[model samples]
Target: MLIGYARVSTLEQREDLQVDALKAAGCDRWYVDHASGAKASRPELDRMFEVLRPGDVVVVWKLDRLGRSVQHLVDVMVRLQGMGVGFRSLTEQMDTTTPGGVLVFNVFAAMAQFERDLIRERTNAGLKAARARGRVGGRRRKLGSSDEAMIRQLYDSGSVTVQEIAGRFGVSRGTIYRTIARTSKG
Candidate 1:
């Protein structure tokens, strides 16, 4: 049995073309997921994989429909292979049932892994450069030690309302409340 998988990023998008293509390609069953490819949890795809069996061919109209990243696609392919399921991508002309197709998939998988490594290396280098330039990353603390101590003192003495402290400290009421709660916890 050939199981077809179709995907669209948004609910507004149509799945007609993918469904027609998959049916035309001789798919016996079909699954459709209307969600972002970047998301790891795809409910429809999970269900399809769980129900797939030996001699089952998982078909997609295009390679992108299978995954957002090449690494992700290869991981899914490996999982399918381990389950004795075959894979077919119409646009990429890939069929995991054949030796040639297996070779092609392996090569693509290796390249994808290499690309990920390069991205990680580049990101690390960029961060190092930024640090050398004295650029601190992430958010700054809302309240300094002196302000925090005063806030705690005021709260402990019950001298001021949370809204009054927030207005005086130039912060939100929630921030004032949280600070009081945190100081109380300590």
Candidate 2:
């Protein structure tokens, strides 16, 4: 079974070209979506996946119609391959059912992984440098010295509950407890 998927970035855009190409490629079933590729949710795409069975090949008019980026394309291809389904892009002449297509897809998958690794390494290095400069990556501290002192005083007075302190400071009760723990440890 050759399933077709056609998409347009906006409602104003027409999917006629893609649909025609997919039909020409001998697609037995069709799924269409009119949404941005950047969006993660696509009801038609999800439905297509649900209807896909082993040995079914998913055909798209173009590679970009199926994924937002190379990484995303690789991920979707890998998932389809794992499920014993194949993929074909009419414009790109990519057919994962062929040996040559498998080789090309493997290279693409490797490149995507390499790109992700490079990004991860750079991010880690940046965070390390920031930490060396006495800067940390996270939300800004919501409580100041005065707030901490007031919270401590309130807790010690035995007249205020943890929830009350948290409400007054606009933080969670767990945060108040952790603050008290840190102060006691210091």
Candidate 3:
């Protein structure tokens, strides 16, 4: 049996075209997910998976209808293959039941991976250059040096509790404790 899957990113969008394609491809029944491609989980997709059998073939209007990313698509393909289930993407004209289809899918996956690697490499290089110029990442400290000194004084005077100091500085009690601990260390 060929089980079809369709997807649209929002409630406002329709899966009419996908449904038509699935039907034309001779799908026995179909599932539709009204969710973003970025989401890792979708109710209809999960439900469809529950009913898949060894000899079943999963059909989709397009590969993107089935997964959020290339990695996700590959993972789904692997799972389907393990279950002896075939995959057919009408738009891509690829079928995991055939050798050429599998080769093309693997090539696409490789390109996606290479693109991700290049993005990561460029980001790392940019960060390295910024660090060389004495620029740093992450949030700035909530408490300045003067504020730390004041917190330490207030903590040592025993006039205020750590909670009271935290309230005064608009920070957490942990920050107050750390400020006092820094005084001991210095």
Model 3 stretches astray by more than 4 angstroms: 155-164, 173-183
- Write out the backbone clash pairs for model 3: none
Q: Write the per-residue lDDT of candidate 2 for residues 1-186, one digit (tens) a residue.
A: 999999999999999999998889999889999999997669999999898999999999999999999899998998899989999999889999999899989999999999999999999999999999999799988998888888888988889899999999999999999888867734
User: Stretches of candidate 1 above 4 Å error?
Assistant: 151-186
Evaluated at residue 71, the lDDT of candidate 2 is 95
> Which model scores highest in lDDT?
2
lDDT of 1 by residue, 1-186 (tens): 999999999999999999999999999889999999998779999999889999899999999998888899999999998999999999889999999999998998899889999999999999899999998887886998789889989877788888888989999999887777766754
Model 3 worst lDDT run, 10 consecutive residues: 177-186
Q: What would the TM-score be for candidate 3 when compared with the true structure?
A: 0.82
lDDT (CA) per prediction: 0.92, 0.92, 0.90
TM-score of each: 0.74, 0.92, 0.82
Off-target runs (Cα >4 Å) in candidate 2 are none
Clashes of 3: 0
| Higher-scoring candidate on TM-score, 2 or 3 | 2
Displacement of the residue 82 alpha carbon in candidate 3, Å: 4.1
Write the residue-wise lDDT of candidate 3 on 142-178 in tens digits: 9999998888788778998999899988999987887
Error of 3 at 114 (Å): 0.8
